[model samples]
Target: MTRETLTWLNTMTLIGHTDRRGTAWHYKASEQGGEPNHYPGAIPLKDVRARLFNWEGVHRRVAVELPASTFTEATHYGLDNKPMRWEVIGNRSALDRSDRDTGAVFGVVGPDYKIHQYSDWLLENVAGLLHDGLSVSSAGLLKGGAVAWVEVSVPENLMTDEGVEFRPNLLATTTMDGSSATVYKRTITDVVCDNTRAVALKESGAEFKVRHSKNSELRLEQARDALQIVDTAADEFRRQVAELCAIAVTEDDWQLFLDRTVPWGTKTGKPDNDYMRLLKEERRENLTYIYRNDPRCAPWHGTAHGVVQAVNTYDHHVRLPQKKEDQEPDRVSSWRTDRNLQRTVDGLFDELDRETYLDLEAVLEQAA
Candidate 1:
């Protein structure tokens, strides 16, 4: 299997989600032949420590022993005019010994890269949220422990006046793979669709990031301010939803929007082959069905908010898996899906308004 496929399978075995007040659907892992990994309510910190992030990332110097025959006397001699037998390279490898990926090398990093133990960071940063009545909703490792995340959310749910119910969560994520920095960001999960939305509003930022360096611990102390977003994200998201709900979208506009968002041709402007054409048509039909009949979207139909919700629900629950064989479906990686959803949200909202008719024309034009 490919690295991405391996990562998806590894992530599925390590992640667990809370019931979300009995609203969260069984994760894709359960549907892909694995038993459901769901907790009844907020997952206890102890449970998170024991079940998910029980291991530490250890730093080891990267080196290789060269055969004496391969080196010339002139090249192998040290500045002291003596032969050198061993030397440490400038880079180090972060290794995890956990059963999930025993002896797996998470990343190669510079000499200055600091190893941030998952359990220690959680104790310092996330343990306090529990005191404020927030509970750990989800905790997991991805990419064979190269990346790890813990989501904290309120015990109950919040609802908008337009009848959209959601839970605001603070996602504390870090990586040993150099894919991301230590980040504390706010996200909103729709109880209806179980779709996680990035809470990146234009006015107030929703995340704090700290690089993997000697001073990361100090910076984490300053990031406590970001944690306050959990208290404010609901109101900001409520306002955003209201703005979108107020914009009217006619049936014709919906069709045009779909035409531009999911066009039916190759990038070279040539028409698709028969098989590709059929797949594109099926995709469009699925989105139409979601917009008109899916409970997650129908409640807000004929509005811009509904259109966005339709696309999000499709990406989360309806889109075809990238790889499938026989009757079993391949596990879809949430990491890839989340990145796509973030881009989709940005594009759909970049110029969305009553006058624009969900303008994603610029994005599509560029892609074309």
Candidate 2:
């Protein structure tokens, strides 16, 4: 596909706990990388209601915690008023005596994920195809409440004879934390470890993002047309993967790729210290492993795809210490690192394509 149009697949799995009120209700989020702004904390039910009325807009789902003592335990009724097995709480705030106390009400409830909603949409969009042997193999939330995605895969009988199990998947995700636009892209998931890398050779027609905004509902309604591009996307991805597989790489070529993609020690003519050298050496090793191991790049382990995977896997899986920060750089959320790595890969490929003098020959030679 055109480098000019390529963008990052910036979405994460939705992480949540069953508890919907108080501090214990929310799932504990890691704060390794400092993301003070997007801390995954729960807000009170009242505050959620306030936001709803104020038109502030929540990304996906909202959770309300009703204690058993406050409300009447009545038989659960579905939207159709049919009685369900489970008991349902009737009044939410019956126990709360204070009515006018409008202070900063903070607790753990949610702007949690709308998991069911997302799943229903996916099924409705592809119901007819699913009946024809295609199925949803994997579905989950990514990066603590940042995004939700579902991967619909081709039937096992229809898989390509690509030596590896490289199947075309329709990866659909919607962002809840406003990290990036909601994207429904056609991609190939390496079924081995479930690693999904965006298919880069050609852009899918169904692969479009709806930016998070006040009019997100309208945008979602529009996304139906985009989601229908699955068949075309799957065909193109197969073609592209086949092309990449045909190309090959050597050890020297791999080294050259590492030289080009991985950052070496800075050339300030200052003390080329032991730590810097160690850092460079570790990165070199990590890149080498990713190049060799990632299944998505298995067919093209020495080609452009391999190099991109090396960078991506390094950033996404490898834990590297920051130069200034005391702790190792933690991911801001689930898909932040993935998104950043993809962005880097996108830019590198773009430069390689457009710039005539951007080859790794010189970098490789210098290292030699």
Candidate 3:
């Protein structure tokens, strides 16, 4: 259901094959879009460990070689045990662009977007099929991996005379391909970074055209209550499960943990009072706050624990349907429930601490 955003054209489904001893297991991932879903999530298994698939025939993992450019989010689940999608902006260890038309550190793709030049005032809209598609955080390669969120940006200095580059490799650059093969191409053009774009991308717009850069909002807090859980678990010992158990004593545990953990975690580019007010008033939460720096998680965060700024609630989030004797709209608000909200929470624990007893997909990856 989620596809084609600012940079996301389609998704490539993936599955994980791992070794028990922490050895890396390479399961082939396909850049193939669409689904002939092979693993029947509906098919009941003799083993209780197996989680049934809700999107059974929707996504399947196949192994195939992709150009170095395609990227995917390291993690794909939301606070709930449901699947979510994200953009894997280029490789972490390789350069991400090529030198083409312009000469800027982040080579010119097309021309600089003239936000101020309202000369035409004509907004280009992708009509019909694209109208309903996802415009942010649409994962392109659709591969899956468990990577911690990192805080860094594409450096201007890193952009050589070539193109906008990064370490590892770039993503979604398969502009051309061989015969008999259908190639996928997604481009980021007229690239310029500015506050106006951010303002326009947030909630409340003309609703005529979809913004293509879906991942633009992944900054933080977009997950709503789900993000609060991540804030609590940021410092939970990896080799222990009790940390989460203490919080899962029923969902109320989250409210308790969040109150304790939420206030202290810092927002990126935020003053203490402002960040606190932002946390108390708004929905978009991003950038984990760091403090005096701890020993274990400190190396990752600060002396304290904080993640990225909360995601901007400017877009959509979820609202759990309330019982009202059929008096209400039957559905919750579109302000809630994104793909990220559906992914398994158990997996998150696994990512935090290997000693975690909860299996990420096991707890939440079920039929809604």
**Against the true structure, whose TM-score is highest?**
1
Clashes counted in candidate 1 amount to 0
Expressed as tens digits, the lDDT of each residue in 1-368 for candidate 2 is 11111111211222111121111111234431222111123222222223211122122222243333323453455466554344323321111112223332211122322212343344345443443434454333333323445555554412344643455656555544434555666655444323455555333223665554434442434444444555455566566556655555568767666666555656664654798778778878876776687564455576544554455445555544353332423333323344433432233322332221224434445555
lDDT of each: 0.64, 0.42, 0.20
Best by lDDT: 1
Worst 10 residues of 2 by lDDT: 2-11
List the candidates ranked by lDDT, beginning with the highest. Answer: 1, 2, 3
Clash count, predicted structure 2: 7
Residue 86, candidate 2: Cα error in Å is 40
- lDDT-wise, the better of 1 and 3 is 1
Q: Candidate 1: global Cα-lDDT?
A: 0.64
* Comparison by lDDT, 1 against 2, better one: 1
TM-scores, all models, native as reference: 0.77, 0.50, 0.19
**Pick by lDDT: 2 or 3, better one:** 2
- Candidate 3 is scored at a TM of 0.19
**Candidate 1 residue runs with Cα over 4 Å from true position:** 1-37, 70-90, 98-103, 200-205, 218-221, 324-368
Angstrom error at residue 11, model 3 = 5.3
